[model samples]
Target chain A: MSIEVENIHKQFGSFTALNDVTLSIPSGELVALLGPSGSGKTTLLRIIAGLERADSGRILFNGEDTTEHHVRERKVGFVFQHYALFKHMTVFDNVAFGLNVRPRGTRPSKSEINAKVMDLLRLVQLEGLAQRYPAQLSGGQRQRIALARALAVEPQVLLLDEPFGALDAQVRAELRRWLRKLHDEIHVTSVFVTHDQEEALEVADRIVVMNKGRIEQAGTPDLVYDHPANPFVLNFLGNVNLFHGRLNQPGADQHGADENAVSYVRSHDIEIERSPQDSTALKAEIRHIQKLGPSVRVTLAIDATGEFIEAELTRDVFKNLGLQQSEQVYVRPRQVRVFVEDYQI
Target chain B: MSAPTTTYAAKANDNHRITEPALVRWGLTVVALVFLAMFLVLPLAAVFSQAFEKGLDVYLTALKEPDTLSSIKLTLITAAVAVPLNLVFGVMAAWAIAKFTFPGKNLLITLIDLPFSVSPVISGLIFVLLFGRQGWLGPWLDAHDTKIVFAVPGIILATIFVTFPFIARELIPLMEAQGRDEEEAALVLGASGLQTFFRVTLPNIKWGIIYGVILCNARAMGEFGAVSVVSGHIRGSTNTVPLHVEILYNEYNYTAAFAVASLLAFLALITLVVKTVAEWKVRQQLGR
Candidate 1:
């Protein structure tokens, strides 16, 4: 199933949750609505699921309008951030809830329902916990069971709102990979909302970056990360050292930035070396050096400007430099991207 | 004195006591226990002791009186009518307050708690002033040959007003803490509003519902001030249990009055037991 949202606008009192947002997800693609908190990613997902109503917009499932539809009629499986599993129901019963609530004529027989629930439980790898209540299970197990319950009705679209947000770091990482494999096998039109950029990049096939209730950029992970549309997208994706001075300065590489625009250079794009007698690289003194496992991050202050910028180098290369704190060195950017407009970090 | 003070400090250090000294602690404990005995336990024991003061036979005869039996029946009827109605209203109001946002929500909650802050006699009078013979709607009711004030309907109305807040008060905090996530999940899973309430929401708050009902029922049966005003003390007709107790005590029928009062006390004891069980059930569910 394909999901389409057109001209959606939602307001909470004076605050705008989504501002004329439009998005279209093709069938069988795992897309992520990625943004920081209050960026309207969750609001868009809820509107798509019919859990929330847009002020004026149309939601279409496979090109059929479903804007007026109730959440139950939308046939979109939604998983909540907190894994809102029914606390009083057993895992099997929770998974079987949708089927059990169906009208008698359309409802499956008891045996068929039982089999289907058990099969879904197995798919989530929680078949052994069929009889256990939700509180008895670990956080990861509870979330998997939540997903299985959502899948029991065979929804046309799967929507998850920070499905692993409540889990610890290790469990979150494990589930991120597991969800990617699960999506491949199931191939539902899945759209998951997440603020964790790494999770979105690693798990989603396409990423929609939203900021301040608007879609800033949407594309495959590599495209958005490498060729961001604006400064917000660039800064949001990863660490970047921003420069406000005019371009063509000493040791500054302007790949796309014009002379007057602000420059943004990735931390790893910086090169540090001892100044040769003839070198024209920007003169700087290393202020601080942090040795991460694979790379060393050195904070350098430019002599001409007294501004601090970070440079990253692999451990082997950094070791060859024999750098010490407060040692004088020259720095140069290898690649720089600049946007014309100003945006606060 | 210095030696004793040193010993007290040593004991405080031994226990890592952050509270007051042993003298103050023991004094406060003794005071509270004595207060409980004076106010709660003694009065409760007096009700039973006075009832049986004459003899077991006299006590039995007093309860077996026609007026006493009728009052008991009337109290039961009032509770039966008032509690279920409040339960429905309480659940609906709590659902609206806890789950959704709208205008005047805080006002509605304040109005729901109006009975608790207002005097019970005034609560009864408000209904009377609207339904009494000379009240706002009194002439209209009189024209239709209907009676409300100082009647069974008025008694039931008064009881309902005082006890309605109990269930809603118990449920709002519970539902607010529980959040609407589970209910929203149920709706997304294809369950209808009614189905979600029954299957997911009701089961989760079943113990809370029971706890509120027990408290409400106890209040409904034992209400004195509100029912006293609305009930015209028409013995064997409109007299509820508390009204009958007042009538007996006023007429110097001390034995009968305490006998009837003992019955209400017994109901209260039973309510306490049931309430404790419900609270335990809530704890167990939450512990899960």
Candidate 2:
């Protein structure tokens, strides 16, 4: 279902957990609420699920106002970060819980419940472990069972809070792909919260970056990564070489910099050369060289400001240039996004 | 030089061992066993021996007496009423304390534990002051011809007061540790409030409830000091098993008194067994 959160606000005693925030999510799209700890992403997700009440907000699910609905009436499926599976229940019973708890008049038949539970189990590829308890399964398997259990009710929307946050790296990678495939098959309007930028970029069709109780930026993964709306998004998304210097307007004398403007560039955007060829080049000394599988990382210390900057170069280029530690080099921005000191988005 | 050094190192390792020597360990074990025999085994053996001294016929006669039979029935009835009341109170108290945050929560918890720290006799006296004929509600109760103190109701009240904290004490920590995530999950899946409680919360805390109920039942059945103060010791009517034993003992009927006491001892043993089984079940549930 399409979700519209309009001007949501939440507070806990003296701390404001969420400010006036608004977001729109289209049906059948997977979106990730990405942020660091205490960034209010999880709070927003909970508000949408009706697990928490926003101090002032209106939530609409497919044009129906759901702000007054109780959690039980919302028909929103939620998967917790800790895989809050009932320990006393078998996998099959956990999946069958929603159907079994239906009011008597509209309840499904015994055979129908059994068939549906089995179908969910098969969908999660956990049919063989239906008799096992949650504690008996691995972390990844438990989360999968939790997902299946949430989907058993055929909810209009699915909400996951850090769905793979507790798993190790390898398992997390595998589950990310599996979750993408599952979304393709079912196409339920899904929102998941995550602190891992890589996981968010890899798994979500659209990413909403949050910071300090506000939405910093929201766009497709590539858009948010390449064209961040502000410094917060740029620094949060990936590594960048921050240069504190005045910006010179196009066609302006290179030596006469505008003292008010400062700029930063991504590590890959900064180019390195053995000799200074132009007035734009800034001389620096190479301090450290790291040879990662296909790329070389060169750490440079600028002579003018004594600031260190990193430049990523391919292994072939590093070898052709004959770069060495403690060697002098000139650096210039091949492509950079410059922001003035008082810049605002 | 290497051989001699190795031997010396081994000797030092033996001297530096953390555990006591074998002889000291055996001595401590013997001491523990002696202590148990003196305190536990002796009392248990004496009860049985004294009860059977005049032979099985007298033992049977004592048990068959009308007053003894009536006392047994009274004790059972009191336990039946008191235990279930306390069980419901405990569940409600635990649910409120574990699952909700509000003002005066700590104070409420402290008040729930009030009965535990207060002496049983004092608890009975508190009720007596409240409901006794010469006490605060005495005039009103007397005018209505309703007797609470020195009656079966008084005995039940005292028993309940002593057993009030058992179930809540058992449940609060367990429920608090389990948290509200599972219940929230159930609600989000379209389960009603009652359904979430019965299907999700109850199953997770089943062992804790069983553990609490067993302890509550034991206390309700075996309480003596509190029940004695309120029961008034009226023969065949108000005297519980413990008070009945006291009356028999005062009349110099040692065998009869010990016989009745032995029945209570047997009840204690059963409670111990049930408690052990419940604890084992809790461990098994948690271990999984």
Candidate 3:
């Protein structure tokens, strides 16, 4: 089901958690709410799930207004950070709970409930753990069981709040990949909250970057990475070499922006050459160079701008050039992304 | 001179040998054993030894008296009413205090703890001041022909007052420590508020609740001063076991009083067992 949150606002006492935040998830899209801690990403996801009420807004599901629906009436499945499994119940019983507690008119027979729970358990590859309580399972297994329990009710929208936040680094990566695969197979409209930028970039079809109870940016990972709407988005997405330089005409009008417009270039787009011959090239002395697995991060000072520039190079390219610290090099900007200072905020 | 020095050295060695770590540890254990024997074990032994001194038939005859039987029955009845009521109040208060923040929260918490700090005798006096014929609201109660003081209600009120904090005190910290995450998760999973409370919140706090119930019941059953003040210590009407024991002691009926006190002690022992089991279960669950 498609989910639409229109101008949602939430406040806890004097602190605003969400400020007129708006977003829409098309049916079957696995959108991610990504931000750092206290960034209001989780709050937004909770509002969507009806676990938290929005102070001012409306949430529509499949084009019908569900702003006043209770969380139980909203039919949104949720998986929590710590699994939040019912410690007293078996895996099968936990999964069958939603089905068994169906409202007045909708009742499932014993065999039907059992079949549905087993099917969900099988789907999560936890069929053998049906009789075991949640405490018996490992962290990853418990999370998978939490997922299966969320799915057992056949919810319209699946909401996960920092679903892998508590797991170890290795398990988190595996679960992210597995979740992506599962989302593809299930084709459920899912919204998952995460503070890890890498996890969001890797797992989400579209990422909503939040900051201080507001959306900083929202787009596909590539778009947000390559073309950040603001400095916050750029710094949040990944490492960047932000240079303060005025855009000079290449003797004529550039691709789009007028001359004298200030712009910045991404580290990957800056070409470092052995010779300082190009007219557009800027001369710099390397200060430090750290060898990453496939790429080398070179920190250098740009002579004209007196700004620190971070440059990235592939291992093969660095080896071929045989660069060293304190070595003078020329950097030519192949592509520059421009932003007017007045329009930044 | 050399002989004298050698003898002195030998005495020093003897002192050092006597002050070994093992010797110190044993000394400490002996001291603890003496204290336990004097205070706890000896007193209990005295109660049992004195009760059976008159033989089994004498104890049976004492128990057969209508006053003793009625006091036991009344005590049990009061406990039955007080324990469950305290349990409900404790859970509700814990839920409210641990789960929400509101105005007068600190004051409300202090009020919950008042029964623990106030003397049991004072607790009975407060009830008497409000419910006695010459006290506040006494006129209204008298006009309505309600006999709260010197009756079962008065006995229950005193028991309830002293035992009020036990269950809630056990549960509040536990519930606060567990937090609202599990309940919120249940809500998001479409569990109704009541279902979430029973299935998620209750299971997690069950041990705390049990621990609280045992403590409340123990206090409720053994309460003496407060119930005596409010129940008027009437022989057949409002006399509780503790009051009846006091009456027997005053009448020089030593064997019977000791017998009844022993019974109350046994009930307290049962409560202690329940508490130990609850603690063990909590420990085992946490260890896993």
Most lDDT-accurate candidate: 1
Candidate 3: where are CA atoms >4 Å away? A247-345, B1-38, B101-103, B284-288
lDDT of 2 by residue, B63-129 (tens): 9999999999999999999989998999989999998888999998999999999999999898889
Expressed as tens digits, the lDDT of each residue in A56-145 for candidate 1 is: 989999999999999999998999998998999999999999999998989999999999999998899888998998989999999999
- Each prediction's Cα lDDT score? 0.91, 0.89, 0.86
In model 2, the runs with Cα more than 4 Å from the true position are: A247-262, A268-300, A309-335, A339-345, B1-33
Which candidate has the top score in TM-score?
1
Cα RMSD of predicted structure 1: 4.2
Error of 1 at A228 (Å): 0.8
How high is the lDDT of residue A260 in model 2? 47
Report the Cα lDDT for residue A210, model 3.
92
lDDT of 3: 0.86
Worst 10 residues of 1 chain B by lDDT: B12-21
Model 3 per-residue lDDT tens digits across residues A142-171: 999999989988899999999999999999
